[model samples]
Every structure is written in structure tokens, then in C-alpha cells.
Target: MSLLREAERCIANQGSHATLNALITTLQHLGPWLERVRDADTRRTQGTSKSAVDGRLIAIKDNICTRDLPTTCASNALDKFTSPFNATAVQQLEEAGAIVAGKSNLDEFGMGSHSINSRFGPVRSLRRNRDGESLSAGGSSGGSAVAVATAQCYAALGTDTGGSVRLPAAYTGTVGFKPSYGLISRWGVVAYANSLDTVGIIGKDVSSVREVFGVVNRPDSRDPTSLSSFTRSRIDSHLRSPALAARATSPLKIGVPLEYNISELSPSVLRAWSRSLAYMRRQGHTIHPVSLPTTTLALSAYYVLAPAEASSNLAKYDGVRYGTRSEGPNSATFPSGYLYASTRGVGFGSEVKRRILLGAFSLSADAMDNYFIQAQRVRRLVQHDFDAVFRAHQPIASGQPETNTNPEKDAVDVLICPTAPSSPPRISSLMDHNPRASPLDAYMNDVFTVPASLAGLPAISVPVTVESTIDSRDADLAGIQVIGQYGDDSLVLKVAELLDGRHL
Candidate 1:
């Protein structure tokens, strides 16, 4: 733990969580984390450094990029932008030695679930409320899961388009993940819904978010929606088949999404989703109960295809070539239509101008065939209802054919549910000057994380807890999730480390 005492214990947990603003550019000094711990101790005394996130630290998520901080996606339209480089997942986590413990805040371009539409405010939650206020840290990766749940950073880097990094790692308990949508590499992130952005992580477990998703998951080629090295070697030869290496040493059916048991959960998240499916059926694993039935129209087809691809990736943040240009009185007789309508009306945020006017009236032309072609045909029937209940086989459905398995009543391999149907609310009851706030009551907290981000699949979230006699710091932790199937994502991080018992 001596990378200078883990960067002085992550700068003393970022100065005791500094009022959980989580981070929006930090490491003002520690001289670049002590010059990368003295260049990893002079490359480990010349044997040449071996790095597996070597000096760790992490954070990131103010909307990815990061050539030395300030990627302010907690936007006043990229407020003083900064990134001239870095963000192939932050240059592969700074070439695997990690560091960058700053730039965390969000929900401006990433658009709120409750990081309270930041411009640099709201991202509080190390869980307070006994009238100590500070709650909703669940947002656009709520300051990267409250800086890895108050440790400040050992893991972060959020993005996940809908369910902004697993509803802030299930409202700040930690863990997150979200990989599998072009498996990590949205060439320096920033574009909100370019086919539902990904690149997620936020850790504290699931083996440090599967060791930073095995180092940026690979294959970028300047990310034209990355995922090709012959489709990641045909998803590593279909997970080393022989029926997926004998169903990975057996015992895992695990589905349970009977439409995510909604009744808006909350009886301690339906008792931590019935005690995490009764502890994964007492670990012999076999839960079934599947049926994705296009999961209640996958949150109205992900708020209409993620605001019609965030109204065409935020129309290149117009204000003459990307945001922050607002001068008024028709800047010299309509200078380029008043600096593109006063720099997106004084630089976004009011939930990014209500999702860019609901992604510009669902990509208008009289509501493009009833809301962007019926939300892209309900996002291909929510990816054909998760490739018809999982059982592996959907490495991007190439050459079709494999979904015919029965393995005991309609297949299954991952899927668990209940990431946010309650727990972590009270940031003044999702403020907007309260009065019973409503942006569809914060888009109903992304209804169980927008059906695995509208089926880009691979998910996570973890957290858990529940058995409460109260006061275990007021127990009820929640956030279950899991998902998978579209490149199974190492069976969704090995079934989220076997439902957080950390693979017991």
C-alpha cells in the first residue's frame, strides 16, 4: 500500500469526502501522484514496471476524456474543456498504472437521475439523512459512485448512457461495471447517446470491477463503436465452447426477471430482491422465473432511443463549434443565429435542457415517425428481449442460429434485477425546488436501469445488504442488477462475483 501511502490514502479520502462533491478535477498537487510513484519506483528498480493498475487511485467520470483533468461534463457546456488527449478509456487507465484521481462530478451531459443536474453542485451521499440531509448521489455516475463510495478513488470512470453507471452503482454502494456496449472505447467519451455510450467501471469490488474490466477491454481503432478483432475473436471463441466449458463448471442458471418484480420494490428493495434470490438458491444456483417481455417497453424505449441519440449527439454542442458561447442581444445582428440560440440557451443543464428538448422533439419532422421510428422499433424489441432470455450465444448475433437451448424451461445465465427501485433518494427528494419534484419523478430512476441500457447488455451494480434490525448504519443497501448476454461480458463479471458473496 505504499505508492506513497496510496497517494496519502487517496489524499485522505479526498479530504474526508469534502462534502461529497465527489471531485471535479483534483490532485491539484501530489505532484502528479508523486510523479507516478517515482515512475513506479524507477520501473521497479529497472526490471521494468509490471502494472495491473499499479498505483491505482482512479475517479474520472466528469464525462471521460482527461488529458490532465477538466473534462467538465458537469457542463456549462464543457466549462473550460481541457482534454487534448487521453480517453481511450483514459488512455487505458493511464497505461494501467491508473492515477488520475479527479474529474468526477456529472449529470449535465450525462443527464441526471439525481446528481442534481450539476454545473458543479449536487453529488452528495455517503448516506446521511437523520436530517443530516445529503442523499441522492445516484446520478450520471454520481460523482463516480461517490468517489468509489467515499474512498475517493480506487476505481471510477463512469459513462453508461441510461442508468448512468448502474444507477450510480446502485445509489452509491459501489461496484457498477456496464461494459459490453462496444466493450469500452468511445474514443474519449463525451457524446451522451451516440448509440448509448458505455465505458463504465466504478469499483470497490467484483474484483475491482474485474480489474478495470481487464484493462479497457481492448480493440479500439479510434472507436467506431469498437468491438472488432473479428468481434473480439468471436467473443473469445464463444467463451471457449464445449457448451461454454461445461456451463463454466455448472450450477448457474440464475435468471429471475419476471419483469423485475416491480411494485416499485422498496420493502428494503423487496428484501434485497428476496434475499438475492434466497442467496442464489442457497448457492446451488437455479432461479429461472424468466420473461423479459420487452421489460415494460424498456423505459419507453429508453426515453425514445436515448433522446434520439441525444438529439444527434448534442448537435455538436452548437455555439459555433461546441458550446459555451453566449453573448446576447443577437450578437451582432444574428451572428450565426444568435450563437446557436444563445449557446444552447446559456449552456445547457435543466436536465441538459430537458434532454435537448427531448432529443429535439424526437428528432423532429413531425416527431420522426411517432417518436424516432417508434424508438427504433422499441430498440429492436429490447434486443429481442435479451436475445430471448440469455443462455449465452449473442456475440452480436452474427450468422444468427444459436438460441434454441432449453436447459430447463427457457434458458438463462445471467439477469438478477433490482438495481434501483428504492434506496438513496432524499437529496431533498430529488430537488428541482421540490414541491414534489417531477421530471417524471426523475425518470422513475431509470426503471431498473433502462433494460440493460436498452440491451447493449452487460451490466452490474452489486451493493446488496438488507437483513436489517435497522442501525447497521440504517441498513437496507439494495442495488442488485447483473444482466449480460451480448458478449456475455465474462458472464457478467462472473455473475457479479456470484452475487457479491464475492464468489463463495
Candidate 2:
């Protein structure tokens, strides 16, 4: 949190609009927002309690509901729309005295990977090269990540259905923590994928994210998907073993998934991965090789399942029942269904349209078993792979614990790997469809991140630099991801601290 104050001071002293412009969403009026916070603080009643985040200026991803600011997901579909209530997460922060900095930008409907599929225009990066060339800020939570990176806010809220939070954190070299699904309530947030969508926190470092996570990680009755007290007790009882407690101060077992060492991994990333592993080994943590065979199929299954869910979730926005109605007639003819068609046609962006079509097709009777069912099967397999590799069992499942017969060869405490295959590509390359970058190219960035999302595991991304210098050495600093079993968020953040902070 202090780092954010330092960033504010730096901005004030330097007067760097370039840094601010690359991050601020043009559709909203945003700034340090100190005056608002001070006014609210003065109105506080005596004996009113405040948590660690009191008086903190925080940014919310535009997708999250906020009563004060408009909740536009950088898409025309919900443009200039204001919610009457705040997201549970937002409400919790405000209760703790955190002020809204602004609603940062994101991909339209949380669809695109590069934040360019927005009516508000793509989110620009604060990262620049020797020639002052711009780079990507990642997406669909790119703007939230950039806000934290530029020191525009103490921490920002983002959603990660499939690496939306992690990828941006990696690209911008900030800390992004995607807690196990259901840890934070998602009731007020716009739905992307009901099952997979998770509200995440982005900060300059692990401490900020940890603090934010502490404030918001609680169950809410509004969100049926939110973890219940019974589930929390289950998670606690399952993980409160003496062995787990003993490992707190002991060396850890870190797994290096062989499948993640794909051919597409850049040399810079490879080097950073190797060095981080070496560092852990030197710290006495055993580095073991593990395999999640379904890793490669995760992205494919995610696209199928997520779109299928999106199609169902977005059905309400027909302009008649939900979306913005057009002033003009529905169509030239066929007045009955024209309103629905025309409103959706104009309201949704190309990417949103594409996913909806794909989702509808997958859910069709002819393709349901072949596509949607198959994708669900793949998702289950992905989850099974993680379960098989983790030392702990699922919090809610009733089963005999899987015994690690060999103490020296037990399941890993965590999996350490690169967050993305390569450093962020230049923004120009991502925007243009030249041979260097195509429409499909952005999807590849999520290759390393989708598996964790599919499995609902706790994952954290922290910046780690490579020892050997290479091309684009500055940007070569990559995010090393630490993933743990479900409900192992504390351990995941503990490892994130080890990698990013002086304290272990």
C-alpha cells in the first residue's frame, strides 16, 4: 500500500501524463481521488471500525458493479450504465474505508485476450522499449493491471475466467492473485462464465494483493456460488494437518510440470524459469518433475465451455427484456424478432458475437454431445490431473485421503512455472494482423494459465528476471506462477512472497 503512495508522489513530482494516459480509461473521469476519500473519512462516526485498507484508493475493473461509477466493460453493450448497488467485493472495500479510484478498462464482455476488442479502444501499455516502442498491457484485465503498475491505485479488482488477471499481471510485471473460485463473492460482477469466472486482485506486489484478498475473501448469501461456512470448515479441517503445518517453516516440494516446458516457450522465459528453480533448490526446496497430461487440452476445453456458458448468460440482453433498445425500428420487416436481433447486432462487439455464435453452435442438439459434452469431459480430466498431483484432497469431497507412501516422492506442495510462454509482444504487433501477429496469436498467451483456471486452483503470478541477457532483456523479465491445491490460497500467497519479497 505504501508503494502506491510512493507511486502517487512520483507521478506528482514527475507530472508524467504519458504513464497516466496509457492506463486511464478515456470514457471516465479518473484521478488520485484523494479529496473524495478525505471527505468520507471526516464524516465517519465515532467508534466506527476500519480495517487495514481504510483510506486506500483502489481501482475497480469496469466489469465490476459500482454504484458511483459507471460499470461499462469497455463495450457498447453496457456503455454509460451505472449500477444501483456495489459489488459485494466493492461494498466490503468501502466498508473498510477504501475509496474508488475509477473503473479501469477491460476487454468487451471480458472476451478478448489483448484488451483491443473494446469499443472504448485498446488499453495501451506503460512498458516501452529502447526506441520508446509500446508493448501490450495484457487483457481482459489489462487496465486493472496497468493501474497498479503505474501506481494509479493501491490495488485494483479484476476478473480471471481464463488468465485474464494473470496474463495482464505477467505482461505488466505486477502481482495478480486469482484465489480459488468462490473465495470471493461474484454476485454484482457481470457474468462472463458463471462457473469459471473469479474476481481477482491486482497489485504492485504480493503484500497489496494479500491485504486486499483478506478484506474481500468471505462468503455472501447473494452469490449461491460463494463458498458456504460448511465448505470453509471443510477446507480448514482438510488442510489443518500437522504435516502441512510442519511444512510452513520447512523446505517445500515444488513441481515443474514437464508438459509446460513446451516448444513455444521463449529462451528468455526458459532461462528465468531455470534460475527460479535453481534459487528454490538452493533454498532447500526439492524441485520435482510432475505431469498434468491434460494441460494441452485445457485451452480448447476452456474456449468451448466458457463460450457455452456465455451464450446462456448473455441471452437476457435482447433489448426487449434487457439490453439497450434501439430508437429505430427493429428491422425493415419481421417486426416480431427484429428488436432482439438488431439490438444484439449493434450492442455486442465482433468478439462477443463470435463467442456467442460458437457457444450456440456447441450447445446445439447435433453438436452438444460431440462438442460441449466432450469439452466438459476434458475439463473434468484437467481437474483430476491437479487432484492427483496435490497432497491435499478437495475440501468438500468425502473420500479417503490419497496416501503418499513415499515421503521423499510425495505429491508437490506447489507447482512453479512461467506465467506466459513469452514476454509481451509489442502493442503494434498485437493490433496488426501481419505475419508476426494474427488474430489467433493472442490465444497462445493463455496457454500456461488456462489449466489452473479450469481446475479452480489458487494461482499467483510474480515477476522474476533471467540471469542471462538476451534480446529485449528489459521485457524479458517474466512472471513465475505458483499454483496450489484448491483452498490453498494462503500457501500460494506465501510462495508468492518468497519469490517477490525479501521475506519468505
Candidate 3:
């Protein structure tokens, strides 16, 4: 069997699987490597041995660097650019025997909540249902989610700065996993917010996502920010302890954050959440109401912090070292600096530019003390709030005192919430109406997701069934997010599986 054959089989069997509609263009861009994978039978074999992932077809997000493919990050700024080196995660996937299928689309620089910001085009959901109405596939990882959902690939890699991975997974009815920050190397990924950006995996199920994570979760010396071996070991040791292991076997205590139940949540989402909680309760898991007061401030804080970091990180693209350079009409009259500004202005999408400007302004001396510093302070409070509610204590560095003194007082092992406040909006509605509305309306899409991202926690979004009448679409998918303490990624996946009835 070949990669395409296997993918075709998946699509035939799985109604909501990937649609390779424009894959010819991708094949042309990927060249010979694409041909090799398409023709090789050895690449499609599946097993649990060292070669388990060998020959497996995998999709790479446009932002994740691949030496053989163009890494545009869904922006025209790098439309003609191909990376010289693979992202560490991409290299790991290849080494594990996975074949790089092609680059998936995304919101420009991972900025948009809906896939609408892409230079390539919006990625539509694979969940067509009976209605035949087209819906968003959640973004900025929407393309990756769609690829996985539609069987375009066995699995796909996406960068999750906030809810990019989980949101799309929810929309497309696939599994999206954002592992503990720094667990996977960020080395070849185009930076959005260096501190918040994480490489995520989107697959057909928890098992596939876990399998992919197992391959890429090792520490990379190249990523200076990668978690150290000692820290990884410490986390593993704690999670494997008899107490934690036994707790895993027993029913878990899941928390429902009061702050997450905002007014904007659709009635369908509310019903799905209620049913999810009811199901968990019936399964013997204890449900508790937890308070994370600072969560209300998370969205505001994230906008401030992420943009600030984005502005600084994006400063490298000054028409000099990387990205396309625009030589003004007259090179004699227009010098280096002048052309750089115009080039960036023309190249980046509106959303990206908006963020860059917001970020740059936040870091300005006048606003730094009031907005940026306050946001950082609020971010810490958000993290503290999470630590205060989870059962496990985050392992602090040696000689660093445990900040979570009230760990014993916390209510649950993990938190449960809706992945998005509402269902996927039509692409036309988002583009025609949203842009004219306040930028904050667009930012609201990240509300349920940003709190977890700000706390650097692991979260997963699993689709739940819903009822809908739009084109009689059978209410195909609704997302329920399961969030765990930092380093408790395995626990989050387990709980998500349990909730989805895959574990039972």
C-alpha cells in the first residue's frame, strides 16, 4: 500500500476524513519526496515496534519548517520561501518513519482564531454532516485539523499558541493535543509568541496523537528553551508514582471553572457541557466547581503579552536576513530601511500587522509600565490560580520553594470546559462581518482557550454530539476541552478518552 492509497482508504471508510482537493499543487511543491512516498508500500505499514511510525503519512503545518517544502506560515511574506532545515519536530517525525505528506494551511503566523486569515484560503471543516453546509474547521491550525479529520494524513502537526490545535480539533471532530510547554522542541517552527507557542498534534484519535507525541517529546539541545532532562524525568517520576497511577485507575475529580461559563457560550455548547459533566458523574468521577478569578483577565493579558513577544520576534524580518525583500522602484532613492517597512506592510496580513502594531505599542516605554507589566503580573496570577486548583504540584526548580502551598486544598485533578463559546461560523460571515466589528470580537474566540495557554498547561479538545437545524446538519460536532496541570498531558488525554467513551 502507498501513502495516498492508505489515505484514500481512510477517507472512504471515515465519512469526515481529509479531502485532498488541492493536493496536486502541494505534490508539485514537494517534488520527488512526495512521489517516493506515494509509490512506496513499505511506508504504509503500521506496527508497535521501533518502526511503528515508519512509512506513516503525516501533514506538517505551514509554520513548521520542512527542508523539502515551502514553510509559508500561511503568509505571503514567505510564499516563495523553502526552509533549509527541518523543524526539530519534523525531523523527529521523519526519523520515527513518518513520511512528510505536505504543508497544511494556517492563520497567518498562527494569529487568527478562525482559518480566515490564511493567505492560501480558509480551511473548511470536514464535518459536512447531512446539511451540506460548509463550516469553519477552527484555526489557526484549521488546515491541520481538516487534514487529519478527512484522512488526508494519518496525523498532522500544528503550532498552538492559544487554542489553535484544540479549537480546530473540536470543529473538525478530531483529536487535538497540546502537550506541556517545552516538552517538544520549537526549533524550526516559525515563532508566534516564543513563550506561549507549542507544537501540537492532531489525529483521528487519542491513541494516534499519543503515538506521535511519544516520538517527538524528547528534549532537543538545539532549542535553548527546551525542558531539561532532569525536569522531564522529575515529571515522569511523579506521574508514574503509585499514588498517581492508582488515582488514574479510579474515578478522577474533574473541575468546572466557574469563570468559563460566560454569557457568549451558545445554548448548544452549554447543553453539551452539561451532558458531558453528567456522563462523567455517571461514570463515578467527582465534579467540583473551582474558581479561577484571574481567568477573566487572561484574554486581555494574552493579547498584551503575545503581541509584545510577536513584535520582538518578528523584528528579524526586516527585508534583510530572512523573508522576501522588496527593492523599491528606485534602489538609488529608496534605501534599506525604507524598503523594509513597505515590504513588511505589503507582505503581512491585516491580522498579523494588527498584532505586530499592538505588540510594538505595548512594549513602548509609555505603555510598558502600565499595560505590559500589568499583563505579565496578571499572567502569573492566572498560573497561580490553576496551580491552586489542580491536585498535583508543579515541580519547582531545586532550592525554589513550592508556590502552590494550598495544593491539598484544591478540588480536582483536571478542569473541563467548552473549547469554544460557540459553534463554527460561516467563513463568509466571519470575513464580511467580523473584520468590520471590533477586533475584540475576533479575540473572543480564544476566551475559553487562552487561560490554559497562559498557564502553560496541557489541554485537549474532543468533539461531542449536538443537535442542529442549519441545513439539517445533525449538529455534527461540539468541543469539550480537558485541561490538566502543567506536565500532566497523559492524564488529560486519558480523561478525554474516558469522556469520549473510547476508554470505557
Task: List residue ranges in candidate 2 displaced over 4 A.
Answer: 1-49, 331-337, 398-408, 432-437, 470-475, 501-504
Q: Could you tell me which 10 consecutive residues in candidate 2 have the lowest summed lDDT?
A: 21-30
Give the lDDT of residue 266 in candidate 3. Answer: 91
- Model 3 residue 267 lDDT? 84
- Give Cα-based local distance difference scores for all models: 0.79, 0.81, 0.80
TM-score of each: 0.36, 0.91, 0.90
Model 2, range 116-165, lDDT digits (tens) per residue?
77777778777776678888888899888887887767788999999999
Q: Could you tell me how far off, in angstroms, the CA of residue 407 lies in candidate 2 after the best superposition?
A: 6.9
Worst 10 residues of 3 by lDDT: 16-25
Candidate 2 TM-score, true structure as reference = 0.91
Best by lDDT: 2
lDDT of 3 by residue, 404-469 (tens): 456554647899999999888766567746556556776888999999999889999987885554
Best by TM-score: 2
Ranking by TM-score: 2, 3, 1
Q: Select the stronger candidate by TM-score from 2 and 3.
A: 2
lDDT of 1 by residue, 321-369 (tens): 7767777665345545454776677788677777778878878899789
